[model samples]
Target: MTTDPKSDGGVTQSPNRPFGLPRWVIGVVPILLLGLVVGGFVATTPLAGVDGGEPLPDVSIDYTTLPNDDTIRLHVTNNAPEPVTISQVHVDDANWQFEMTGAGGDRTLEPLESATIEIPYSWMEEYDYSVTVIADNGATFSTTIVAANSSPGLTGQVVWTLTVIGFLIGIVPIALGIMWFPFMQTMSKKWLNAMLAFSAGVLGYLIFDGGFEAFETAQSVPSGYSGPLLVVLGISGAWLLLQAVMDWLTDDEGESRLSLAYSAALGIGLHNLAEGLAIGAAFATGRTSLGMFLIIGFMIHNVTEGPVIIAPLADGNRPSLVHFVAFGLLAGAPAILGGWIGVSTQSPLLNTLFLAIGVGALLQVVFDIGDIVRRTGSIRSAPNMMGFAIGLVFMYATGLFTL
Candidate 1:
């Protein structure tokens, strides 16, 4: 009977494979895994560091006593393998005196050696300043002083202002997205393609030109980095994080794209906050030119980000003003945070690293949204391409590329 059945191929049929996995199961896992990996990389990888660590030479400044009457004692140590030289000491008041016992201007010492610098000053109010240190190997480190009795009032006010400004600016994206929705929907595929191409151009230019330049400028300001190796790693890590996040929020094959949209928005928000901090901090620390540049560049980028936020909502067949505002807030709050952080810390390495992360994250975002936009309508439309070109023009006009 078995032979007959086999030979006859009676109704050749295979046993059912336990419902492999719902479509969601297939799509969700890979996407989730990818996203998680990307997030991990973004969080952990030091793209702006030396050998994946903080780039500046390691040096410690110890204060022996608080400023009371006569003088405040402090000690500076070179902890890294390289020789560190004290380039400049900036104190607030003239009453404060800086005395370098050893070779002051360009003193060179091997790692683990200590130098005692006495700052004899009598001041009732607490103070802060930047001390620039140059390594024998030409690595520079700039550390900002934070007093134990630092005034939180001034700092708190600055933080509050930044938060308000960020919140306000965030609304623009939501508005722009809504206003342009009708226009984008009517565009032809060719136009759409043009738009995407334009978007790609802007992002590409920013990453290769603006992003790289920012990193170099950062390296120049305070001696940092072992070279391009760290920069490449940083870029890779950022991409990995972006991929991980996208995968995490994406559903199974052919599933809804809402989760990914949400995740991207969240990432964008976090990114903006970091940017805001950069602007605020630079202004706070007397880097107005740099701060202004970042603000203008980001503002343009944020405008484009608005459309990305709403695309998901549209896909779900639901769009509302309330949700728009909420997304705006989520996206915009970062400016304030970025501003505050930038102002608070005087670490050039930290600032530059954060900037690189922003660049990386933004690149991921452009790619993710571009994918969505293309699928919605054909990318072969004229208007759509024009829109994208307009966006790119903004970037270029702002000198984001030249920087």
Candidate 2:
């Protein structure tokens, strides 16, 4: 034993071989204790998505303040193929970094999903605030906003809004169609020819509207020409699909006319889908009033669409109730599906594709109607031309509402 004058001559505590423990074991005791401490820390540490820190991709970040609670929520919209990690959320810098160690506090977010991070109001200051998120792979996502103390109206209100705009748009026209076939049945051949031409005119207007929207949507992409190219391809694909159906089915008059009517319905269905998408997107983005207006506008347009769907069947043969219902479902149900998808994913390319398909179907339908009218030998008669003009005017006028 050794004594130290600083310790008032107390016995020194020194290592010796007198104890039972081996020197090698003593050498490793501190190391084992240190390893246990490190292991505990790692076990408790809340890592996002991966065990190791890594970057995440394809995430859209949005920040908004919760006025009632004075808390800020980070909304991360994940659109990647795989799950991603968002480890650290900080404001301004690490000085205002938040601890995200709570259960389900954004450990992992699945593909095409969303997660939220909440930061306390105490951390906010009266400067232009920026929130930065660091992923496990060191990918950083950041956004700037007015200070959290600002009035609530300045921030976006985030809500997952689902709408039935498509169904409302469809039902009006379908109801009108229920009265059409019987009412038109007793009319003379002159009226029938005129009505077919009118329906063709309605289709003519739709082609222009749908084509324009499709091209515009496409031009939003980096490659401006892609929009026009997609339009051409969509038209070609629609024509080809209809042609394939025609070749597979009958060439007989009744069956052929029925097929044509259904084809028109398919075209109109595609067009309505685009409209539904717009309505849904408006609502999804918190534009409730805009959605309502769109529904009203599209409803009027849809009412005219009913005539076009039934035009192919307007020949001498009166269609059964089953046929009317079939056309209605074929044309109208697609809008509802489109609305659902539109609200969930606002994909412009997909919308453009749908418009292009509608273009192809409607254009083909117009030609078929014209062919039928031509066969009647009154393609330019007063009734046909006057009805066509009236139909065209009606359709164009509907566009004036700016819905």
Candidate 3:
């Protein structure tokens, strides 16, 4: 008797089976279809709506800018569950006439919608101003601008200035730090291991530092976005993504010293990007002193990061000049882009997200370095322990200057 080749052990293949698709796809399709059906039903029905008592008027002043000496522009968002009408605006307790724009150029703002208010008032420099917005439902929201100055625009002069600042704080400092690579090569094996431990300590300190900054920045994000949750998601996503990439790059034999060095550079680079954003935001907000302080502090703080990148490769093959240069740029160039974006388009959510990602990257690097320290010797050993402690102390000392 002739038998069909498609039959397996007298069981015939089902004609309904997809020809080229995997079996998992076949299973997933039904789940997705069910989800879509349920989602459509919920969206079409009133089941998605929640009646959380009475609708309260809530609003947030996302940012304020001075377009000219006589103009005070406010970017406002409605965080209420119901639409809100901006009834009036007050500058320094005095009612001011303002022109509304955005959200259909009306005073009424739908839930989670944003609008801009332009008030033609003579705002003095080096002064503090309190701007308050009154809602139609008798709700009020206010924000204070300290030492008010013209917000930086995307003009050529401003861009050039930011570029110079970015180069000074980002590229120059990191390049100086990487200069330690040759010196690291001459250290003894024990000292090399200690340096690796130190790198971990530095990264450990940074993880906390970045995490704190991210959480702090998240507080400024709109309530609807759930800033704290965004930080959590950002950190988790970045950590898992980087961990996967690292795992894919490493072979069964294990992670190479060169790969570890590159990873350290990437982690430090992300941290520097956040620093750039902070500095840029400070400047954009007219906190020149704070910006300068951050510049100096980051320059010093980042110098220590160079050793972290090179310490892993010190005992192994010396990377060529191209690799060293690549490492420096990888660790520093993000600062330039970050500074520009932070100044030109200041978004608390974005800043918080980047900082969270940086924290995650640093966390991964810290563990990777810990593994190296373990292979070198017991991390609890005197030299390694001291190195780690010193790294934390040094970063803290440098960080104090920025604060």
Best by TM-score: 3
Kindly list the per-residue Cα lDDT of model 2 for residues 1-403, writing each as its tens digit. 6556434235433355314456788888899999999998788875544565433365556334433335566656555667767777777785344434322564676665666667775434455667787767777778775543422221223222333455677756755764577667777878988988889888888898888888888764223225578889998888777777776888687787788888888888888788777665554443446556655776776787787777667665787788788778778877777767665555666788889998988888887788778877679999999888888898898776644
Which segments of candidate 3 are over 4 A away from where they belong? 1-53, 252-255, 290-295
Model 3 vs. true fold: TM: 0.85
Model 1 stretches astray by more than 4 angstroms: 1-79, 82-96, 99-154, 170-179, 182-210, 220-228, 252-256, 263-267, 286-301, 312-316, 319-326, 369-387, 398-403
Error of 2 at 58 (Å): 14
TM-score of each: 0.56, 0.61, 0.85
Count of clashes in candidate 1: 40
Off by over 4 Å in 2: 1-163, 222-225, 290-294
Query: All candidates' lDDT scores?
Result: 0.55, 0.70, 0.82
The RMSD of every model to the true structure, in order and in angstroms, is: 12.7, 23.4, 5.1
lDDT of 1: 0.55
**What TM-score would candidate 1 get against the native?**
0.56
